[model samples]
Target: MKKKIWVNIAFQVGALVLALLSTTLLLLAAGAPPFQAYAAILKGAFGSAGSLETLLITWSPLLLTTAGVLITFSAGLWNIGVEGQMAMGAIFTTWMLRLLQETSLPPALTIVLGILAGIVGGALWAGLAGALKTFGGVNEIFGGLGLNFVSTALTIYLVFGPWKRPGVGSMSGTEPFDRSLWLPTLPDTELSLWSLTLSLLALVIIIVLLRGTHFGLRLKAVGKNPKSAFLMGVPTWQYSMLAFLLCGALVGLAGAIQVTGVYHRLLPNISSGYGFLGLLVSMLVNYQAVWVAPVAFFFAAVNVGSIQLQLMYKLDSSFSGVMQSLLVLLVLLGEGARQRFLRKH
Candidate 1:
């Protein structure tokens, strides 16, 4: 076991080195100094107190989304509709906030309700996908993709129609929520300590649940061999559904955090591809709960640092995305190589 662990770590480190080398080559091709660009990235991500705060803010939702992805992946489910689920969550959170923005309810209570609504919204969206897979014989991937489009359209319609800013609504999004509806942020920064705390707590809970629970073991068995697990009396279908629901709830919470803790409004692209990004994080970490947070933080830093690349090098921020894709590709290739080596030996 220890040998396997060390081998895994070595492969990851080698993959990182290769990824960086590939990214450097790309930078050179684009007429930029690779070292300088890397320096700027680090600076943008952590050079200042404000930048560090922003990094933490970005990390919060990312950690939550990735944790959710980890759960579904462990259950052998492809929950690609996390994007839609997140959008639904944001929509639900906004709906609750809009309805109660003018009420006499305490801010804390109102925010809690809004968050819960977000969770329900996400769970419902994910549940639909799970039902289609289990009962309708539809592939989760296709169903999820279709649902994602529908959710995006719905968000656009709401933003440009009934929920549009007072009048003459553009695609910008709905009007910002009342200040009182916003999540409480740390002093002198846009970072929401409440959201961050919740994210950390959720991570701890997930780690415990996945590593130390019978339900998690059953889910793993279902993923590894549903027929065998069923023969052993494990309710494979039920456990699969539970995994989907749990994933949806966490992702939905991420969406709610984005709305209340960051954007303060429901936008057409409110999800901002964090769902997809979270998928990458989950894959890179091999679904280990212990590695999710650090991987999330690294990705968040890359994302935040890309802004500096755009500003200083006049480079397209998509370069950061390229680096991310390369990292995942290299990691996958390295894993494959490691397996082949073990098989040959």
Candidate 2:
């Protein structure tokens, strides 16, 4: 067992090295100094209090999304519609805030209601995908993708039609809410302690749920073999739907934070690709809840850090994405190789 553990660690380290080596070659090809570029990223992510603040802000939503995806992944569900679910969440939150902004209710209560509405919206969207899979024989992947498109279209329509700003609607999104409705943030930063705390709490809850619960064991059984799990009397479809609802709720919180804590308004691309990114994070960690927080934070740091590459080297911020994709690909390949090696030995 110890040897196997060491082997696992070695392969992980090897994958990390390969990823960095590939990223270096790519940077060199791009006429950028690899070491300096890396240094700049490190500095940009941690160089100042402000940078750390931005990193934390980015980290919070990522934590939420990653935590959410962990649940669906465990249930053997693709849940690609997470993006749409997030959009619905933001839409619902924005709508709720707008409806109550002028009401006699306190802003704090209004914000809580908006967040709750976001959670409901996300669950409803995910429930649609789950129902299609459970009852309509539609694969979750296709159903999710289709729902994502619909959600995007709905967001566009709302931003351009009913929820349009005064005079004319622009892609910039709806008019901003009053400051009183905003989530409380640390002084001089967009990092909302409320959002951050909630995100961390969600992560902890998911970790405990997945690691120490009979539900998790059954869910894993369902994922590994649905027919077998059903034979064992597990209600596979119901569990699957429950997974979808739970995941959507968590990620919906991410969308809610994006609105109340960060953007302060509904906007196009409000999910910020965090849903897809969360998928990558889940893949990278092999859906192990324990690793989600650190991996998500690393991704967040890379994202925040890559801004320096664009500013200093005239490089596109997508360089960070390239690095991330490479990392995930190599790690997965390494895992496969390790398994093959073990079998051979």
Candidate 3:
């Protein structure tokens, strides 16, 4: 058992080293000084108070998204529709705020209702995908992809049509809400303690629920073999739907944070690709809940720091994406190689 553990660690470390080596070569090929670029990324992420603040701001939504995906993953679902779910969440939040902002309701109540609406919106969207998979015999991946496009279209229509700004429609999104409706934040920064606290709380809850609960065990069983789990009396379809709904709820909360805590209004790309990025984070962590926070934070830091790559080295920020992809790919490959090696020995 100890030997097996050591082998696992060795493989993981080898994967990390290969990922870094590949990234370094790519930087050299692009004529960027690899060491300087690395230093700049580190500095941009944590060099000062403001950079740290921005990193934390980026980390919050990522935490939520990653947490949401972890649930779906545990239930053996891809849930590619998470991006759409997030957009629908923002749309619903915006809709609810607009509905109540003119009422005599207190601003605090309005914000809470908006966030709740966002959660419902995300669940409704995920329910649609689950319905398609369960009853329509469509695969979740294709159903989710279709729903994602529809969600994008919906956002565009609202932004450019009904929710258009005062004079004309634009991609700038609808008019901003009053500051009273915005989530409370640290004095001068965009970082909201409420969002941070909620995200961390969500992460903690998910970790506990997945690691300690009978429900999590059954869910994983269903994921591993639906037929066997059903034979064992697990309500398979219900569990699948529940997973989708729960994932959607967390994702929707992320969208709510984006509106009330960050952007202060809806945007066409309000999901900011975090849904998809969360998928990468999940994959990198091998669907382990405990690793989600640190991996998501690292990804967030890379995203926040990549801005300096463009400014200081004239490199496209897509370098960060490349590095992320390589790391995930190499790690997966390394895991595969390790399994083959163990089998051979």
| TM-scores vs. true structure, each candidate | 0.97, 0.98, 0.98
**Candidate 3: what lDDT?**
0.93
Error of 3 at 117 (Å): 0.5
Give the per-residue lDDT digits (tens) of candidate 2, residues 254-273. 89989998999999889988
Count clashing residue pairs per candidate: 0, 0, 0
| Cα RMSD to the true fold for all candidates | 1.3, 1.0, 1.0
Q: Residue by residue across 1-345, what tens digits does model 3's lDDT show?
A: 998999899999999999999999999999999999999999999988999999999999899989998998998999999999999999999999999999999999999999999999998998899989999998989999999999999999999999889999899998999999999988988789999999999999999889999999999988889999999999999999999999999999999999999998989999989999999999999999999989999998998888899999999999889988899999999999988878895
lDDT of model 2, residue 216: 89
Candidate 1: residue 268 lDDT (0-100): 94
- Candidate 2 clashes: the total is 0
